[model samples]
Target chain A: MMEATNAELYRLVLTDAPYVIGAYAILWIAFVVYLSMVLARMMRLEKEVDLLESAVSKRSGE
Target chain B: MKQLRTAIVLVAIGGLLTTAAFLMAFFTAEVQQFGTVTLEQEVDTVFPVAPDQFQPPAGEGIAYVRPWFSQKIFYFHVPVAEASFLVLIISAVFAIRFLTSKRAEFDTKSRIAMETALVFVVLTMITGVLWTRASWGVWWEWEPRLTTYFIMMLMMIAYFVLRNSIEEEERRATYAAVFAVVAAINAPISFMITRVIPSNHPVVFQPGMASSNLLPFIIGQIGMLMIGYGIYTARMTEERLRERVEIAKEALEG
Candidate 1:
């Protein structure tokens, strides 16, 4: 009875493992994707700001 | 500049804490007993055929408490749900402030917070769906909490639609702020629906949770809040950079 009950625990863990792993995987992936997006946007804005600064400096020089 | 640094630090700390909570949930926390169910016939589950808790009669099984339903998902689900609710409130509060102050910064803050709220809400829904599948053996159900939370998600989506439809800046801000406030009302209602109405959804925040469960839950909640704030602040930093670019464009034109 004891050994079988323990096996039941193992079976339960194995059975539910997919849903548990899936939930956590989705969360971590979402964070990674979200952070990547923010970083990409920031980089684009930096490039634009650099271009604008040079243009402004060039204009003032002229 | 300092805020961005703080945000990074918070994200790092939050990530570590949540990871620890996840580990503890599986390793240290005792498997919670959800009580028993009386079955007219045998059910196919990973549970033992006849544990001590089982009541015996042929084809009539009194099942033992099954940890298979919510034990694992509860850690992630509850934290994300609470964080989403908190972030929604933050967005609504900023929206109200924007309305009163007529400040563009407040509007930016509110908008960024709304984006964060939406992200958390999506995560909550995803985790919740997984839980329902494991517990109820279905991908979707029209239970009270699920229905109300679905409405909340739709309202949030409509908020962005309303924002995108407007071209003028002030008008867009005004409309979005109002919409944000309206959409945020769903968070509290969705949260309380399980308690107020009958729900198959387990109500987890009552006084009787074991220390084993409560400890990890608290850690997970704190970590999620920090992560939410970190994300919001980081997004705000990006918005500030965009504003700088806009200012430079105006300077060139002037």
Candidate 2:
């Protein structure tokens, strides 16, 4: 009976492995998503600044 | 440009260090044993074995303990949690400066810091939940430590909502700054409450971590702080560019 119980516990541990993997997956995904959002915002802002600078120079020349 | 360059370097270094820490955790650190597993071994006695003796002496071994997978999450969760609180304190410092100086620049700094804090807080919550679920078999609990953190998260979100609701720029900054200060106060209270109240959360430092465990933890901490600072600087650069564009437009109009 004791041998069977120990074997069962070990099997449970193996079954629980996926939860551990899931936790790490969520962590990496959250960081990557945030990084991408920041990068996208930066690109949008850069385009806006370029357009505004060109507009300012064009108007000043006139 | 120089600030952006520095931020990039910090992020790259942080990434490398964190990867190294993760490797060490899996390959080098000892798996902490929490419960005992009984083992039967031969008993050597001075006298001859008696017929009444049914079994041999019991021996203890660390290898018999079940694998502690949840312990691995500690390396990441703790560093993120500490970084979140530190950033909150920094945001409050900028908030106080803004209140006294009433400079838009100070306000912008405070707001950016708070934004960084928000990101960390969210990450902390997610990781905390994962750890709790893995260890305790529950996804959510209303324990003091967790409840305090939930309140802190709400207050942070409310700070941004308050800023958005107000139309006047100065009034918005003032309200947000005050809220940030309140959030700062809440942060330490939340952290200390865990110590005051007994909780299931393992105290990693109370009993000194093994040197093998300490190395990865330290590496993770430094890496996490670098990433936090990198995120903050990147946002700051974007905000500054937006401000410059607004100024150029105003000059054109003038």
Candidate 3:
């Protein structure tokens, strides 16, 4: 009887595990993705300014 | 640079705390029973229907103490939802400040805060749906709390749309600020709807929680707030960088 009860509880846990896991996964993934986007934007902006400076300097020399 | 470093530090600490809370919620905290399940009517549940232990008789069955695995969701959901609301109010406060002072910085701050609020709100909605599915056996429902929160999300989206539709900076900022304040109004309404009106969404507030449960919940709340602040600050730094680039570009052209 005890083993059967434990088995039932385990089944319930497995059933609900997806939703719980999904929630945590979504939360963390969203945070990491957003942070990465911000970092990517910063890098691109820095690169753009660098290229812009070089282009202007090259034109001045020409 | 200094601000970005501080933001990173906060995010690291916040991430660790939230992760700790998540772990504690599963291993240390005791799950609360919202209510009992009865076999009187056909109901969808994760629990075994009329298990041997819960089986009363063929004709009649009493209410069973079915464990709610979804109760674990409460810790994270409550904190994220509250964080969203707090950030919305922050946006509105900055919006009001911008309207009064006519400062560009305040407008930017309001916009960033709104962005952060939207992110948290989306996270809340996702977790909320999962909770509903796990606990209530529904993927979506037109309940009061859910409906109010959906409206709040729409309002936040509309605020940004209003900002983009207008080309003039000052006019756009003014309109978005007004919309921000209006959207902030919905935050409280949505939060209170679960208590004020009859709703299936469990109210985690009002004491009576075991210290084990409360510890993870409190930690999650503080962690979420710190995360929200870190995201806000980092985004602000990025905005400042963009402004500098714009200034430099114009200087070159001139």
Chain B TM-score by candidate, in order shown: 0.89, 0.88, 0.90
- Could you report the Cα RMSD, in angstroms, for every candidate shown? 3.9, 5.7, 4.8
True contacts kept of 3: 0.40
Count of backbone collisions within predicted model 1: 0
Residue A48 of model 3 has an lDDT of 77
Error of 3 at B15 (Å): 0.6
Off by over 4 Å in 2: A1-10, B36-64
Better of 1 and 3 by lDDT: 3
Proportion of native contacts kept per candidate = 0.49, 0.39, 0.40
Task: Give the candidate number with the greatest TM-score.
Answer: 1
User: Per-residue lDDT tens digits of candidate 1, residues B29-75?
Assistant: 87765545444455455554446646656554455555654568888
Candidate 1 collision pairs:
none
Q: What value does the TM-score of chain B take for model 3?
A: 0.90
User: Could you give candidate 1's per-residue lDDT for residues A1-62 as a string of tens digits?
Assistant: 12224445556546767888899889988987998788789888989999998899999899
TM-score for each model = 0.89, 0.87, 0.88
DockQ of 2: 0.41
Higher-TM-score candidate of 2 and 3: 3
lDDT of 2 by residue, A1-62 (tens): 12324454456455545665666677678777887887788788888888989999999899
**Per-model C-alpha lDDT, please?**
0.84, 0.79, 0.86
- How many backbone clashes can be found in candidate 2? 0
- For model 3, the superposed segments whose C-alpha errors exceed 4 Å read A1-5, A49-62, B34-64
